[model samples]
Target chain A: MPTQILYKPLTPEQEKRRRQRNIAIALSVAALVAIFYAITLVRLGSNVFLRPD
Target chain B: MSLVSESDLGQQSDFGSAASDASPSDYVALLKPRVMSLSIFTAFAGMLMAPHPVHPMIGAIALLAIAVGAGASGALNMWYDSDIDRLMARTANRPIPAGRMARGEALAFGLVLSAFAVLTLGLAANWLAGGLLAFTIFYYVVVYTMWLKRSTPQNIVIGGAAGALPPMVGYAAAAGSLDLSSLLLFTLIFVWTPPHFWSLALVKAGDYGRAGVPMAPNVWGPDATRLQILLYSLLLAPIGALPWILGYAGPVYGAIACLGGLGMILGGWAVFSRREGDLARKTAMRNFGFSILYLFTLFAVLVVERLTTIWLGA
Candidate 1:
């Protein structure tokens, strides 16, 4: 038979912390994507494919 | 709903609450940030050592992709090894085993990150780096964590390849291919791994034995493991000097490598000479600590040498 595991609900403080942490992670991921795109723009503008003779 | 029993309602509530309990940090913990950092640093060194120049942005992207791929492997390893992880005191508090994150959630997270890292790296850099990253993830998760870890004493010997590949991947990212220098870097890490990991295995042999993992000290006797560590250290010391001997690194790097190599040998000797209770454990711990410092110092010196050359235009 499968084991029955009990779960406890988070306290208010824990729940608040979780929400804040999630928000931070979302913001960080967004920032990384933005940085990547910004760099891509700079690379394209600089003529990445052209080589100096 | 009308026919549902109270027990069923309780079980449903428990399951729902479990999802809410996982914090973002718990998810980040799944990534094994420390291991990711080491891999990133080594990869960065490889990039800097390569003859070809990479744009700063592209280098950053390649590094980020590699870091993400490493994290994906860590998460998958944790998910699969949760059973043994719970058994070991050192790993018992990890997010998965601690119930902060569900195993299924970790598995899905790892898979998604693995795919994303490979695809993005292929687009940003070249396919070689991307392919290496994908293979590294597969090797760590499938070959190391799932297969070798439980099955043999030589687990770390083979599994170390995954850890050793990041520099080569970074070299490929910057140069668009690999060469002898990158292979030397890979070999250095590969040879260094056994002595580095075995010291910890010696200290944690009981935990491994209890978990039914065939770590070196348990499979081979402690005396034999100690001797093997010393032997590997002997090989590693000379190999550590090869970059300088090969004309890639400067005199400063050569000096540090020589000193670090000696330190590793001394640490190994201490472990080999002393094999009693507390003294033996202390010696093993010292070797473990010194091994980390040795690798870090060697890599740092390489970075410094490269930066100096670049600054001097020599």
Candidate 2:
């Protein structure tokens, strides 16, 4: 069984800020993934090996 | 009372006491040395397998970038997960959640280091390598840390792309381009991610679940996760044999990779087939621990093989 640790349940305003922070984290990661994906797509132009065998 | 924005208030609340002169040990901790050691190994493999000459200084810089980039990701991960980290015993003592450092401070430090790693790698090496380094940092921070973590059970699987990027960065640094062997090397790590991660996840399921992290065992249940671990280990055996199959590495590396990857699969399978008890946990831990050694040996063999060829002037 896992232990459930309690967080100081936030005020609505605090919750909103936490949500914003989560969004910022998500966007930052998404941007990085997009960059990596873009790199893959760019390299795929020259990556004939990733092309059909 | 009227002028300060809500955003400022939140930032202030998150920010904790200032850290003292960034202790030398603390700075080293920032690099996430365990992660760096793995990144450095894969980067070295990428460099070794690539067909080109690299000035030793440039090569050193490239490794440093990968190391710093990995640390940057770790710091950012710590920053974001501090809330949950405070719950998990395994992670509770990390610099941030331990209250030794502020959450905001950790995030700022991570962002700064991430930028520095990417910028210097781009400047010191070619932009291709720099670009890859930047992508890796982002991938770990965003894709893994933010997206997949709490959002889905497949977190480690999809998020593994960042971890797989180091070999490519190393390859791009040395050769200034892509090739079959490099991508193959990348694939090996990508496939290995699930088993390597899930084993730890299995043991730490309580920690992860308590923190609201959607680890596979938490989200999908232990049995399914165990099956998934086995499936990936099977995939690992063949993919890890690529360097030899592709003729980039000699029989020595080929044999080791095959044996090592196969051993990983067997160990993982044995754990899966076992009854849930100390024996099973120990088996899984052994497989998990061995996976690290397997990867290092597989790559280290490449360096030795290359130097051997050079020494014999082959």
Candidate 3:
């Protein structure tokens, strides 16, 4: 026989923690992407931003 | 038995489906990020070592493709070896084995990433780099994981070529071809792999035995494995010195390489001399740790020397 299982809603504190963790992860990934971009700019040298003309 | 309600069936199905649910982190875990980092660093070194200049955007894209390809290979390996991985303590908690991700999901993810990496590289960079990336993925997944890992004790020895080829790929990306310097980089990593991996195998022989994988220490006995490590170390030391001999690296790099090479040889000697028990395990691990340091130091010196030469015109 199959048994029924009820879904439980998260408590306020648990929801807060989940939101915080997600934000942290999103920020970390954003930081990593930014760093890769910065490295690319540096590698491209002054010619990227400066023009002799 | 009484008939079950539709609600009960729905709940049961939901409970069953929960096990297959995966988070973003689970997908990332399939990538083996540490291994990808090593590939990225070595490939970056190869790109920097090239005599020809690469457009920065192209170089970045090439590296990104290499990293994705490495991750794809790692994911495929995890998917195929999930059964043995469950048997081994060290890998028992990987995504597939731990049930965080399904086997089919991992397989599809790996295949998608592999195609994405290869196609992106082919379109953005030269076809040669893309071709090499595709070949590396095929070699690691098909040759190493599916075939050699279970069949032979020489698994790492032969399979190390896939790991060794990233530098060549990077060189091809930057310069559109390879040269002696890039080949030396490839050779150095190839020779270093055996001693590094064998040391780990010595420590994990029981795990490998349990998993039915024919690692060197299990097949050849610890004594023979130690001797092999020593022999490889001897070959590796001279190969480590080749960058300077070829006039690519400066004297500082040469000195560090010589000292690091000697240290690697001595570490191997320590492993070889301590023939049994915990002492042998410790020494083997020490050799393993030193081998990583040796490779990192050699590459670091090369990169630093090149950067300084370009910056200061020294």
**Top model number, lDDT:** 1
At residue B256, candidate 2 shows an lDDT of 97
Candidate 2 Cα deviation (angstroms), residue B145: 0.3
Candidate 2 Cα RMSD (Å): 12.1
Pairwise TM-score winner, candidates 1 and 3: 1
Where does the lowest 10-residue lDDT sum fall in candidate 3 chain B?
Answer: B10-19
Candidate 2 on B1-314: residue-level lDDT in tens?
33444444433355542212233344456557898889998998888777765666678777877888898899898888878889999888887767556677678878988887887677666899999898888889888998888899888999988899899999998888989988988898999889999988888889998899999999889889889999999989989888799898899988999899889889878868974888878887888899888988988898888767766764
Ranking by DockQ: 1, 3, 2
Query: What is candidate 1's lDDT per residue for B1-314, written digit by digit as tens?
Result: 23444365343232234334577787789999999999999999899888966878889889999999999999999989989999989999998778666677788889988998998788788899999999999999999999999999999999999999999999999999999888988999999999999999999999999899999999998999999999999999999999999988889889998999999999999999999989999999999999999999999999888878777884
Candidate models: Cα lDDT each: 0.88, 0.80, 0.85
Clashing pairs in 1: none
lDDT of 1 at B94: 96
Pairs that collide in candidate 3 are none
Best of the two (2, 3) by TM-score: 3
Model 2, B109: alpha-carbon shift in Å?
Answer: 1.2
Off by over 4 Å in 3: A1-53, B1-19
**How would you order the candidates by TM-score, starting with the best?**
1, 3, 2
